[model samples]
Target: MTDLAGHEGAWREFRAALASPRMHHAWMLTGLKGLGKGQFARAAAAELVAEPGIPQPPAEAHPDILIPEHPPENKDEAKKREDGGEYRRKRAIPIEEIRTLIQRLHTRPTLGSRRAVIIDPADDLERNAANALLKALEEPPAGTYFLLVTHRPGRLLPTIRSRCRVLRFNPLDHAAMERILRESAPQAEAAARAAAIAAAEGSPGAALDFVDQDLGRLHQVMLRLIAEGDEHFALRGELAEEIGTRPDRERQQAAVDLARAVVAAELGRGDARRNQAVIQVHGDLVRLSGQLPTYNFDPALVVMEIGALLASLAMPREAA
Candidate 1:
């Protein structure tokens, strides 16, 4: 909940900005996923709603501390009813939503000394939506701030990015991750957490995916297959049944994704000294993912063809 950047300078800068009562109208947090972008955004917002050493705001979704909620007009806004679409759905934060948020910001704070809004992954804003938000940022209301968090700042409108103060968030050290893993997920082995760090590519939330039993099995199997060829065709039928029978569209896509990652890793065994192999397998991976909804490419066939192609790169003909 506290500023975890641990850099006294960044904290001082923010606190000084707060003292001046002129926090950046829009702050862009640029970083990789799971590096606590959302958590940091909430922390920044809470500075307005919930100060350090004080109790946290009753709920992060409180109206004064606005984080965009997706309600499709069928649900009550005050009660925060679910609109059937998950909160993470990729719909633009409508102009209407922004206008309502502005109305809330102008009202006297319900609890905290200040008011804040956070738009996670601000890069998701549609072109028109981004421009609309930019207009507001151009003339942000006094005593209110917007924390725009994202993994890809380059994807945001250049004009939008220019309007904000950019803060780059980096990953926590191994020790920090170990501490978090111990408290939050003791069931995970220390080594598992460490290995997950590698897979996360420096994202903490990403490593949490290892908690899934299915993904754990896949991660291990995937790594093994990458280092050593899985000559047995046993996994193909297993993969097919697992993928073909996924109950939801999301799970089905995840299965194709799992296969793609497995084969892609194998293809990248070296410094891509075998890049042709990597390219060929990457194309198959894309095809496999693309066809998950449209066609029924036998998963076994896909895996075998991928395996065979990678295997060929190691054959005697390529030795010359």
Candidate 2:
């Protein structure tokens, strides 16, 4: 469990829940990506599995632990529907799967003090699956625990969120990020340490992304856009296209982080022009962040929309 980075005070939170006369059946462990929600759930699971005399859960084999992933068993049905062959399997976690998980929870644990089911990114659950989960949350089996980890807790069924205890996990601090960077890349410790501290934005897991060496380029680009601004059509377009092609949602967030960094750097310089550019671009980033969850938005549209906004910021303006 030491391997899980960026989450502190997890044990305290867990103990608080346990101390209650009646622990909530469900828990919404919400945080941004790579903040160790899964690890926290696992640690909680260990406690649930730990017998009165046992110090820890059974590491080798634990019947009380359950972790479900995406792309449900009926994913073939989803592909068929997408291809227009058959209309079926509309979402990631299906009702039947949730029912099965529920059914398993009905019985006493084969081994351990209690039973626990961890649904990582529980927001991915289909509407029907979520409804089924809601029922279980309403009438939970005694001694059973439901740990739902999600980056987008807002997407979950409102009823589900209301019934559960919510625990928020904040990102890592500079010292933590530096320690992680040092352990991962000793050879580049100095540079990695600095970049991780800068790019982390309070998440140690994000620090690893800097190892790809793109952090410098990212910093340079944001610097120019915030300072000199970019009138070069090709240069602006190039950056847009590159961002458009990045599929990882977190990278999109990182782009937003880069915008925030631009704001910070420009504000410190006290250059009115750069400050104005930073403010405008930061607004654009806020817009883009809101748009990211829509699956139907074209990558090009995203790029062009934000790119045009960035391009407009290049123009020198009179003080307001």
Candidate 3:
């Protein structure tokens, strides 16, 4: 397992739990997105199943560890194509997936005395799936440890939340973020790295994503447009074309996120009217961006809509 960065406190807590005579079977790992909560869960699971004097196998090769059938980050939605079908994007952990995991937990561990069940981002669980998982957590099989990763703990059932010990993961510090960036993207340009670090706001995963997709350039464009209003539609069209033309969901998400960040950076300026306008656009962006996944809206149209909202911030109060 890769060493998790900027989470030493969490590691120490987990290790202490392991060293205890009676370890908690269920642990809730809560944090913002891309803070390595899932990675920590996997490492902890590996520790549970690890034996003395034996080499640790990769997560997938371990028989005693179980993860969600479809990890949220990698899950895709199948779109009907003329040729047949192709996956685009999808989200959700269904009841059947949970049931399968539960059934497997009932069996004895294949490799060790303990088994590890990991639900990456338990927030993605459907209502029925969450209930089914709640039952497992309630009466987990002996020698079984459940590591639930949740970016939004509030969304989980109160009963489920009550059953497990919660470990909060905070954003990484600048030093930790830099160390991770060096390890993850050794060849990235200095400018790109700087942009990613600033834009990531202490999330290594988000930073890496920005670097991998070359989103720093897009972020710069957003900042420039926000700073200097696009009197003509030229800048907006260019940005929209760059993001909307690509079918990659990650790129689209990054664009929306960057735009929101740019607008949010303008908050708390001396001008109250401009601050209110920025606040409104930020909220609108959040709502509209959400619909992209739920309604499968056209990415181009969405970018245009975001552009329009952002453009409003550049307008003078006198013109309003």
Candidate 4:
């Protein structure tokens, strides 16, 4: 019933650790994005906090579990009208919140002796917040458990990694990704579903996000552009005309994302020249994607440049 198709190994390893007489107080569920590390951490935390013979409560209502994420800057205000109905979530988890959670962790658990603190994507923690967390991890309470989920464990303090048992989650296989799509988006046409899975690169979350953005059509366009012997210049112009002409931020991002996916698909082949070109192009695209908000640049112009770059990369060198 649980969606852990590609992670049976991790599950077995966790279960083995649980069966041991001495249980670790801190666990780091670390892996690539969209591999369900947060989900697994929450499930384990719930199970850990549940009383004997009773099912774990929903994460939102679990008394023994505390999830401290990024709260809005203005804690009192529900939201600003112009910024939408709810206050925008802060960019980082503040130190005050982590301190509060640590204080609670040291106290006796209301539900039982066991308690859990789940920090999803712990990478978002600020320096002070991370240090606060590190202090708790250094000497956690007797019955407390810290479940930290991070897409990039390398970013965390080395001391924090040393204090926890690391569990790595790998990307799902193609078959498992397709199965998940079939269940989650059964209404999608067969071709669309296939495109979504291809774009996902074995991550169901990526597939869902792609399909939601209607990127299947863009995928087809990118595939044709990259096909062998294709005329890259003309294809680039056409793609720029189609995607770059729009000034919308979302559209521009989707166009760059599609192009990056193509580059990723073509990377690391035996062709050294092609690898270098795609890598450079992909890097520029990534940087541009990040800088879009800061400057008032024309989306079409940026994408056309990207197209031209890809074309140059695809061109065959002059015959020897």
Candidate 5:
């Protein structure tokens, strides 16, 4: 079971609501991505579908619950057909999927007093699919509960948002982030863990993703590049080339993210001269990252360009 970590307050509130006489039929778990919103919804649903006085069943064992999310595009149709016509996951949860859930909910519960449905990210629902869900929320079947997880609740229909109870989740604090890092990356050295946590900026999910990376070393390199100004083009170019050559997208993205964090830290240190340069570099990195897939830009050239910009910022006026 994934620990809720910094979400104790939200959990306590939910438990209290469950114990109340007038329990809500639907709830929207609103939080930034990677804050464990999906895990909380699944755990809560398990308890909801369990028989009274019985321990909550595991997610897989709970027959009266359904957790649906957008599937990968590469889902195997033959495998799905072989599995007795089970719904093949798709890139988006279409109206067809919601209709299927609606049809299932209309029937009596198979395992317990209630049926529970959890949508890990309701934001992925298309217009028609969202409307289909709205009907269910408007007139929910008896003994049915809906848990909708959304990073951006504002994008949901106003009527849907109005009908559901909203549970807000905040980002984790430093202590909570450190604890999560220790649990998730026990094999990581202390310095690596600390660097990841600092780079995470109070997000455990971010910290966990960075645990295996040598962010501590990378951070120092970034600082050294900035400190060296534009004097050593060779060193800066070499560092950028290394960053650009990583094969895995996630690793490369994480490295870029950590580089931004280092700049943010530099900005925080009250250095006025480099503020404009830092901001420009950060903006350029973000723009380049967004366009990398669509434009097929070479990552090595991208990094090198960023390095040149940084170096030029430190050039003396006479040299300029």
Candidate 6:
């Protein structure tokens, strides 16, 4: 239960629930990406499984607490080069994991009177897996608690949503974000930190990403390209080559995110025609970003297209 910034209200609500005679068996912690919903879920679960007057054990060591992982597949099979020597692609929480969790729930708590299960970003549960989990939520074992952390609650089964008490975690404000940044990124330069804060738009996790990846430099390059427009084809080519072919996945993601933020910021400015152009580019960026992972499109081509979209923003308006 480390210090969690920008979630005092949620903490208070949770404490009140614990104090109540009738506590909720299921809690859905919902919020945007990079917020601390997952952290809060783990902390709450730890509290539930801890023995009275004894020090709480780390999450990994607690028998009464479970956080489901992507169950291992094909243990006999050797790693493939295409798979980066391992299965690295995003995977869903399969039905086997939920079934196992449910089996464990039937047993008595190992330490405290309560047992806890945390499904982080429960959004990753496969369809069958989610259904299996739904059954447990509907008829949870006595003294068992489920904490489901989700960035998009809409993706969850309606029945699951109905069963859980939803706790909405809001984004961190400037002060809270600063406190987190100071602690997590103490060595980050003031300029880089400021840029990260501005680009994060209230998500301390995202701010940390910007600082850790030195995305502020990338962001400045993006701004320069936007300001200079399509006149510099070579510059665009270089920019595309740099991010598109990089082995660093984090840099690629940061670039796409920053690009969208820049275009979104431009949407409300200028006249109707210019605003429309910005809107179109913003939509394109969103679509492209989504498609990149699913379709496995060439990264360089995507970067080039993104550059073209930014260039379009600088196009001159025809005389009225």
Predicted candidate 1 versus true structure: per-residue lDDT over 1-320, tens digit per residue: 35664334455666677677456677888876667877767766766566556566444756567876443433354234354433333234556666666667667766656678788768656576677778878887766778898766876888888989987777667676676667767888767776665555455666665444345554554444445454574544344454344335455544445545455555445544565666666676666655554455555565555445434444332540
Q: lDDT (0-100) at residue 275 of candidate 1?
A: 59
Query: Per-residue lDDT for 1-320 in model 6, tens only?
Result: 55578888998899899889999999999986688888788888887777768777788778888999874445422255345565553457888889999889878988879988999879889899999999998888899999999977887999999999999988778888888899999999888888888877777888898888777766776776767786758668767655656534456667777788778777667888888888888888877755554365566766788788887787775410
Q: Which pairs of residues have clashing backbones in candidate 6?
A: none
Which model, 1 or 6, shows the larger lDDT? 6
- Give the Cα RMSD of candidate 1: 5.9
lDDT (0-100) at residue 204 of candidate 2?
59
TM-score order of candidates, top first: 3, 6, 4, 2, 5, 1
**What C-alpha lDDT, on a 0 to 100 scale, does residue 163 get in candidate 2?**
88
Candidate 5 lDDT over 37-148, as tens digits, reads: 8888988887677786666667856768877656533557646756777644454687877888889987898867888889878977878999999999999999899999
Ten-residue stretch with the least lDDT total in model 5: 288-297
Q: What is the lDDT of residue 282 in candidate 2?
A: 65
Predicted structure 1: lDDT: 0.61
Model 5 bad stretches (over 4 Å): 1-3, 53-56, 75-91, 213-320
Superposition TM-score, candidate 5 onto the true structure: 0.72
lDDT of 4 by residue, 41-88 (tens): 877777677788666678768888999977765744435634566655
TM-scores for all candidates: the values are 0.68, 0.74, 0.85, 0.80, 0.72, 0.84
Clashing pairs in 2: 172-202
| C-alpha RMSD values across all candidates | 5.9, 5.6, 4.0, 4.3, 5.2, 3.7
Model 1, which residues run further than 4 Å from truth?
1-13, 20-22, 49-56, 59-63, 72-92, 105-113, 224-244, 247-320
Decide which is better by lDDT, 3 or 5. Answer: 3
Model number with the top TM-score:
3
**Pairs that collide, model 4:** none
* Candidate 6: residue 66 lDDT (0-100): 91
